[model samples]
Target chain A: MTTSFPMNAGDVPYSYSKNSHLQREVLDGAKEMMKEVIIEHLDIKNMLSSSNKFYIIDLGCSIGPNTFNSMQHVVQVVKDKYHDNILEFQVFFNDHVNNDFNTLFRSLPVDRSYYASGVPGSFHGRLFPSRSIHVAHCSSAIHWLSKTPKELLDEKSSSWNKGLINYIGASNIEVMNAYVAQFEKDMEMFFNARAEEIVPGGMMVLISPQLSEHLLKFFGSSLLDLVNEGKLDESLVNSFNVPVYFPSIEDMTKVVEKNDCFSIERVELTHPKSKLVDEADAKTLMINLRAVLEGLFINHFGSKIAKEAFTRTILKSDEVSAWMKINYKKACQLFIALKRK
Target chain B: MTTSFPMNAGDVPYSYSKNSHLQREVLDGAKEMMKEVIIEHLDIKNMLSSSNKFYIIDLGCSIGPNTFNSMQHVVQVVKDKYHDNILEFQVFFNDHVNNDFNTLFRSLPVDRSYYASGVPGSFHGRLFPSRSIHVAHCSSAIHWLSKTPKELLDEKSSSWNKGLINYIGASNIEVMNAYVAQFEKDMEMFFNARAEEIVPGGMMVLISPQLSEHLLKFFGSSLLDLVNEGKLDESLVNSFNVPVYFPSIEDMTKVVEKNDCFSIERVELTHPKSKLVDEADAKTLMINLRAVLEGLFINHFGSKIAKEAFTRTILKSDEVSAWMKINYKKACQLFIALKRK
Candidate 1:
């Protein structure tokens, strides 16, 4: 079975809260777009007339500082739209049950404009009561598939992704198709749940990373190096597969259309400029990647092997860093806005 | 400032979850009364007509197995009352910002009847949208004053509780008055916040321990012993005051009447039978008391002195346990239910 865990939690040196600069950059780039979409499509008058309180849910909100910023921005946008009306905003910050909610709640902004609550669960299932949420926001999340596709793990299947951690740079069409199929199923579940939770006129804004082959290639090569040196087993590498899928614009559109619960208002692919461009050294890149993937690696290959692989990945940082610089210029992030019908 | 930390978190050997059998007994005794009050006074028809959703807030809900059980019983009672109606229950489990919400959320029942959310905040202030909640339940909490009475800390003040941690059975009327004054202010804030949150016909049920002089006397004398032995300073005991108060029935009624928000439906003093009568040994008593008071002790007198004090207390448990056995027979718990006008 494919397993999903939360990002490295708390504000320790390697925690997701400390190492999520890449996610912050994406959020910064999407802020204007989010504001624009709310202005163009949000049914503010209807929402206010229905209730004096506005409910916003942040699905996949990991231990924050970023989730706090994102939710604050969304509340601000809504507040600006209803400047004359007095409205109370209650934001629900949601994540996996195992997320470090103690850290999240403790570090909450003391002067926040909205009442905050944390809902812990997978977003691929029902979380809130039907027609309860006014707006749903998910960012830097949902690229994670619910689990690894079973077809890729079956020995008799042509889709078995042997010697590869992900389908990013794999030449095998069957492996890539397996990943795509899993993404489709996960998106359908996500949309169906959101459809039930969000009010009919409510909106959903999602921002997730598109595929980046160089990073996965570097990760796979690092593991292969350990195998070649007789420090790791080839069978272990064959059995491991990353439970992340970066869907294309077409793939997302098809899934949304199939659900028929939300009308896609806007879709864009943009290469968000990194604010830490000058500081994006090899060590910094490795820390960022490790912050997101360390738990997954430890769960699959054990901490000792995970540590060794990361050390090896950093040793070849010069080549990886150059490739990342080139890859940074491509459109590598997807933003989509949908309105519940 | 009177620092309020959470209960000893997680399910460790010394955690509150393992040591809260006394609280469990109180909850069990209050269950029948709670159901009777709901049936007699709950404006269920008005609530159901106003909205299909029912909201319940468990104020000061620490990490749980008790909380899960309490909330489930509440849901069952409501469901039994409205068997033919389709109603949705959403329970908000609230505690201090420093509470172990990570453990609470992870340990939630797999087959819960309500949508669960963790609200991290003090219940003495507003934690929900105004006029949104249907029922508010607080058990074995709220005897905690928002802070220790400032007068008790001032050496010049006549109310200064010198060499004593609490006002239980204290000969000084001024020290007792100081505690009563703090409880009055805290109850005012608590009722005002809950009055705004609870809908016009909503209900609130509160269960708190009444004054038990033997327990606090044992605790005070234990610390005094440390001072006599020169292991602790007398001045530290003079400055330290426990932030808890076990209000008499008259104290609670006066505060509720002064608030002028809710009409008191029932007020009863109960002596819950202990199911652990056979297990009420010296070590068991120490563990139970330690689980609830360890954080408080550690906060006031460093962990070293706290350990020394508890060791001394347990050494004299034979006398203390006898006192506890008698104290257990008297009415030691207060149950009050109120309905919003």
Candidate 2:
């Protein structure tokens, strides 16, 4: 294939090979939503006597636990609804063809009730025939940018906040805005396609990271005390790239409703309480933050200062510790269910 | 449910029912095209292998021996494709809710591969779920209007001629145009909604009676000559209220493609030749003509004259005889397919 596209900041030391941890977290999230959405949508008891076939698809699926967890419920629901109706099920696990499907499929559950396959293209919308699916399962993947958004690269972009200064060597707000724009665009395509493809009454449940505008303002007011103390190298933090694009529940609802294909059936947001926490969980939380700032750190003092800066920042952030303690317990998560109109 | 509107048109008999035999004959003519279009467009091989679930719907499915025969192939291809996979299928045999499906399903072959059900709804493309069908099939159903096209009614509003001049009645061009306009409008809604429901790669095959623009000057043009010869009731014929939309292949292609959801794949037209001499078959072939002319002769001079008039009309015209002979052997039919783009 011709490579006409210019390279951008993508791929990392972890890459697809090391993304199993993400999958595990996503699987846990899916398990939680099935009870909330699928049972209520299907009216399982009423349908038990009929042998209507049912299906679920995990769109933008990464490897591991999500594929396993979603398939389990998809299969379970089919069995529950049509135990006597000669029900047969197929669980579609889809993502970009370039993703590590080998690892994903290897980790998939081999239940007789579930079968998985790769769609071999971008998952911009629903990919099955009409009225053929009962549920749609997605987690942690929609936030990834479909492509880098434009308008974010210009230093003078409207998204830029003049008063908001970058700490050390860091990207301006424009860069971050571009990534988010990309996320929004991709999600538009994904949701619109899904609207056309989902059964008239089927449900789609999604879980993804989100950054509330309220929290962003609170942070801007001076949440990063570590950066003032040289405890955290804002430079290092800026260099790291966290591919996830977190949108507030309100923003997500707008995207889902754009095409009149979906009605937001439910929404849940979890925010932790305590503002401080200890180091171990802090590392887990800061991993994404660190990656974004890594570039700036290397640009500043090269790799040595960047590595040192990461440790220094954590040691100094008492407030982050407190916030993490509360947030971890609070379960900083956002969920929404959209049904075909 | 509360009735928001008044019910109308029930007491009125659908004048177009007079052409039911013609509808059957036209559809019969297109069997091969219908089969090929359904088989290729439905793409059961892909549907079965990719998912363990399947769905199919046939709209305007009359006493559907043809639908059953074609579906037999669909079921077989699907079964063969998914023999290694855990496959399940749900098929909905749909037509006008009042269509004699009791007989249709009786003929449906025993296929262990699928669970079948009856779906009763008008095929304005509104019955099934969005993005839920693996395959949807419609044959010979679209050309029949939901009710008589209004233009064909006699001055007393007693007769409705839908471009069809009954052998005993006159035809009004204006009345026929009115019916044609309604046909165009109704079909727009039908194809648009169908487009929205099919999955990105799903298939839709439509086989219906069509008047080919290509054949119009050559074949359809000659029918008017019979009008001059008094064999066809040009005035009473204009009073025929049957809704006939003989959309050319290009016309259907344009409609399906405009929605932007479907990609036109293949199209074909089949012509049914009149059969060799057989009393029962001949009677069926002439049923509609007989019904219409009988009304005129009986009204003018009772049953005896009606018989005499019908016999004289049939015996006098060698062209009518030739047409009857050719049509008895074969009927003209058209097939079209539009897959999700």
For model 2, state the Cα shift of residue B308 in Å.
97
lDDT of every model, 2 decimals = 0.85, 0.52
Candidate 1 stretches with Cα past 4 Å from truth are: A48-50, A211-214, A277-282, B48-50, B211-213, B277-283, B329-331
Q: What local lDDT score does residue A105 receive in model 1, on the 0 to 100 scale? A: 96
Over the stretch A35-73, how does candidate 1's per-residue lDDT look in tens digits? 999989998787556568889999989988899999999
Q: Would you give the TM-score of chain B in model 2?
A: 0.64
Each model's TM-score? Answer: 0.97, 0.41
lDDT of 2 by residue, A1-341 (tens): 20011111234443333323433553455564656566566553442224344566777665545466666866776567445655545566666544444345445453435434434235664455445556787776676555433343234566432232221123465555555566677778887777755667778888764422112222322324446766555543333333346676866877776667887778877542213122424443344345433443355446665565456554545555565456554345577887776
Task: Tell me how candidate 1 scores on lDDT.
Answer: 0.85
The alpha-carbon deviation from the true structure for residue A52 of candidate 1, after best TM-score superposition, in angstroms, is 0.8
lDDT of 2 by residue, B146-254 (tens): 5555535565554454333321133545554565566666777787767655666777777765422111222222234445676555554344333345666766776
